[model samples]
Target: MIATDTLDTPAAVGSSAPAATPALPRGLAGTPDDKEMLRSAVELTRDIATARPEVYWPDMLLSAGLGYAALAGAILIGNPVLAALSGVVSALALYRALLFIHELTHIHKNALPGFRFGWNLLVGIPMLTPSLMYEGVHTLHHARTRYGTAEDPEYLPLALMKPWSLPLFALVALLLPIGLLIRSAVLVPLGAVIPPLRRLVWERASALSINPEFRRRPPEGEFARMVFWQELGASAWALFVMWWSATHSWRPLLIGIAVISLTALLNQIRTLVAHLWENEGEAMTVTGQYLDSVNVPPPALLAPLWAPVGLRYHALHHLLPSMPYHSLAEAHRRIVRHLGVDSTYQKGNYSGLLPLVGRLARSTMLPR
Candidate 1:
């Protein structure tokens, strides 16, 4: 079982004395916990906590199916305008499908039965992003002591970085498709013959982490067995695609890469605003992490298209990491209704993507 930290219970809502606050270095430390608000998040949302397989199965399958169908249309269609439109549709759908990897990371393995394997076969391996990349890695970002610290694989102090870093970060995602192809088709297969190379690839190249210094620990037991198969499947698929492109047609492969590149670019932009990215290297309190993270809640129509699944409520996810995506909206609603407008819970909620990105960009301009 995954270990969770007990929240520091503060005085009730509207209490004169505030919650305990942690002292940290320069950067946004976020507001102290409203213990009542945190309790309400758990108590009020219990009914909706269960992951509904009915919802999970159809949504993932439809998204993957639509993505591939649209990709085929993009490749085969003669007209430039129509093909471009098809490519855009393909990217958006596949992007949504790929993000199920995030869900796979959080959900209990038994919750959805064969959902993980189904997703790997349909979307993960085909996209060259096996669930192994995210499963063990993402949970660390939620670890109480690790979050916002250098130990967190997903946490980077981007808001504290130089202004050039933001654009460079987004631009680099354009090359991810090519990078994955090389890693799976070339590096991984080569690692089988070279033991040191195998260790380095597993430690360095296997995870889907943004932190430059984060090296993954080796997998153990069932997870290690799972990784071996996932690597073999991905490598086989990658090699087949490369050989087929060489023998048959380069057009299909190039067009597929282009579409996936657009998908990667979309995800990179969503990631930019996932957090305020202002924690530096501090070991933030749970409330502090929630505040530093963002929630692009409703009234933002375009958020669901880009930040699909439950990602729009990323801040809320920090609060309730085990909550399923389909239940987040209802959870947000219940918590908001209980806490009222003027609460620490409401503070994390932002208007939309551009404003959040603008906030981060402006933060970068401040003297470090």
Candidate 2:
């Protein structure tokens, strides 16, 4: 899930209004009494947090390979029916592959070196979402003091907003490709030439954030060099896309951008229901965070496609942020079997996305 982030400035290019002053949702706004149990459940899942290359590498490779293949087929075949078909397939696969950025943040720096490099080289640069965009931003979302507060870069209570806000929130993904392109091609290189503009671009353009007010500081040391190279790679790719469009053909680049746009849209839909969106800028307990978040359990097979890469267990990931993606399901199962359906650990589970999103939409319509 691309977590909700509140921007301080005007909403980014495709966004609706800057997040309005947040209102407290009417239900479940306080700390839960079962904090200890939630903590214990998280502790129990800690053992499974180790990243395994065999598991991570195959999924990453296959998703990237299939996604590029589908896009290539779309461009080469030049049939409207096949193009649309392949575009959807490409979007799904690429979205899943790109989500590994979330894993990269949570994984220890020493782990998954090859996956890191390969992901940045393929999906990250091509999609214009290199790891640097997420590296420093995501950790703030997990901070205990900041999780649901105004200070948290990745949180906004969409359920508490006006009814009109829902569509804007979900549809903003359609605008991300244009926004990212301008940020990389125009802003990044320009910033390098003009020293003072560097900070402005870094804060406003560097991260894939929802928070307009969140300012990313300049990277230092080795990470600084990595950010420079990543930006160069994306900028170069952006130029190549332009060159391809001008010289040989626009079909390939257009299809690639279409896939990226669709990837963002699908991710936006997943973000919409990742949580209840119930936090009202309050400091939430570990239990509060779990209850305020959500999971779509078994038999909801479509959950995997929409919320791929263990995002189907979003609430559980929040509970045990260190747990690897492959291990989330087992951790969830163990908690359910040991703690039973009625456990506070299970409070975040939802039957499906529709009810959760519907209930949130309805909640915002009624007077608070």
Top candidate when judged by TM-score against the true structure: 1
Worst lDDT run of 10 residues, candidate 1, spans 1-10
Clashing pairs in 2: 4-154, 6-211, 7-211, 7-212, 7-213, 8-212, 8-213
Candidate 2 per-residue lDDT over residues 268-321, each given as its tens digit: 888888877777787876767777788997978799999999999999888888
Off by over 4 Å in 1: 1-27
lDDT of each: 0.92, 0.82
Reference-based TM-score, model 2: 0.90
- Model 1 residue 93 CA deviation (Å) reads 0.2
As a TM-score, model 1 comes out at 0.93
What tens-digit string does per-residue lDDT give for candidate 1 at 216-257? 999999999999999999999999999999999999999999
Deviation in angstroms for 304 in model 2?
0.8
